[model samples]
Target: MTITIPTGDLVGVLSDVVNFAHPKPDGGVLNCVRLNWDGEYLHATATDRIRAGISTWHKDDEPDDDGQDDLFSNWGGADNPWSILMPLDDAKDVISNYKLGPKEYRVPLTIDLHQGVLKIERSRDTGHSRLVMQIQGVLEEFPDVREILANNDRVKPVTGQLYTAKFLADFAKVRARGPLQLAFAEGLTHITIGKRFVGAIAPLPEDRAAA
Candidate 1:
C-alpha cells in the first residue's frame, strides 16, 4: 500500500508539539531525539517545538517496507556531527547549521527498530539538515491535549482603562529560569520588564476581556 497526502497535511500535524530546543554536544549519550512518522509513503512530520515546520518532497503514496531504504537514501550524504546518537549534545549544532528553503525540496524519514534509532533528513545541492533521534523513550500524550492546543490562541482581552504597567516600579514580581513561567497577572495583560516583576499592560483590542 502507498501512503500519500498533500504537503499541507503535515503542517497541521507538525504544529502539535515542538518543545525541544536544539541539541548540545557532550561526551555523554544522546538525550534528545528527532522523531518522524512515516505512513509508509504519504508524508513525514517532526518538530523542535520552540519552532516547528514540515517538509514534503516529490514522492508517491504507497506503503512500502523500505522505511530503512528511505533512511539510507536520505542520511547517506550529509555533514553531520561525529556522534550519531547524542542529540542532546549535538542538537544545537544541527539546527544552527542545517540549511533548508531556497528551492524545491524533499526529505525522508527512517525508523530503525533493530538499531533503536530514528532520523529525518533533507538534502540540498549544497548541504543537508538531519536529525538522528530515538524511538519510544519519550511520551507526551495527554488526555486534554485539545486544551493545550486551544491555549495558544483563545486568550480573552483585558478590559477597562488600559495602561502599560512596568515591573517593580508598579507591581509584584518573581524570577525563574524558563520562558512563559514569569507571568504578569491581576489585570487584562501582564507585562514584565526584567526581574522587577508584577507589570501589567492593557490587553490588546482582540484580547480585551468583557467589562
Candidate 2:
C-alpha cells in the first residue's frame, strides 16, 4: 500500500480550508487542530458532532512508539508558525501507510516541534518518493488528540444524528425542477442545485427573447 504526495503542497491546500466543526452534546475536546507542517503529510478526519474518519501522512521518519518529542527543534528552517492539530491515527487505523522515495520504503518517523520538520531514515527496500516542506518551529505543546477519541460518549449510538437530520431536511427541500445552471470559466467547474430564488435562475429558452 503506497500513497505519496508533496507534504508542503498537501499542507498548503488543506490549511487554506480545513474547518470541521463539532456541535454534538457530549462532543469532547473544545480545542482545534493546528496541523503542524513538518515537511510530512499527515491525513486526519473528525466529525464535527457525529461520525469520524482518519488519514495518514508521509513523515521523514515514523514516530517512535511513545509518539512524543518533536524533531523540528533540530531541523531549524526559520522562526516559528502556528500548529494545527487534527485527531489522526498513525498508519495503524488511518489511511494506508505509504512509501517515501525511490528504492526505499518502510522507515520510521520523528516529529520535531522545535525544528518544525519530520525526520525520516531512508531504508533500501521499496521505491518511495521524497517530499519537502518549509516549516518553522511549532511552539506550545499540541493538545493531546487521542483524549477526545477515547471519550466514552463518542461511541454513543446517536453519533452525528444532528448532522444527519440537517442533511436530510436540506435534501428534501431540493426543487424537483432539476439542477440549475450557474456559470463557467477557465480552470473552474460551476454546479448549481436547489437554490430557489426567482431571480437567480435564468429564463427558460421559450421565455427568452433572443431571436
Best by TM-score: 1
Q: After superposition, which runs of candidate 2 have C-alpha atoms over 4 Å from their true positions? A: 1-17, 21-54, 58-114, 117-133, 157-160, 163-211
RMSD of 1: 14.4
Output the worst ten-in-a-row residue range by lDDT, candidate 2: 195-204
- Cα error, candidate 1, residue 62 (Å): 19
Q: What are the root-mean-square deviations of the candidates from the true structure over C-alphas?
A: 14.4, 17.9
lDDT leader: 2
**Candidate-wise lDDT, in order:** 0.29, 0.30
For residues 99-201, write the lDDT of model 2, one tens digit per residue. 3332222232223333343332222222234422223323345434334343322222211111234522322332222354433222121223323211111
lDDT for residue 106 in candidate 1, whole number 0-100: 30
Error of 1 at 102 (Å): 1.4
Q: Any runs in candidate 1 off by more than 4 Å, and if so which?
A: 1-90, 96-101, 107-116, 120-147, 151-155, 159-211
TM-score of each: 0.28, 0.27
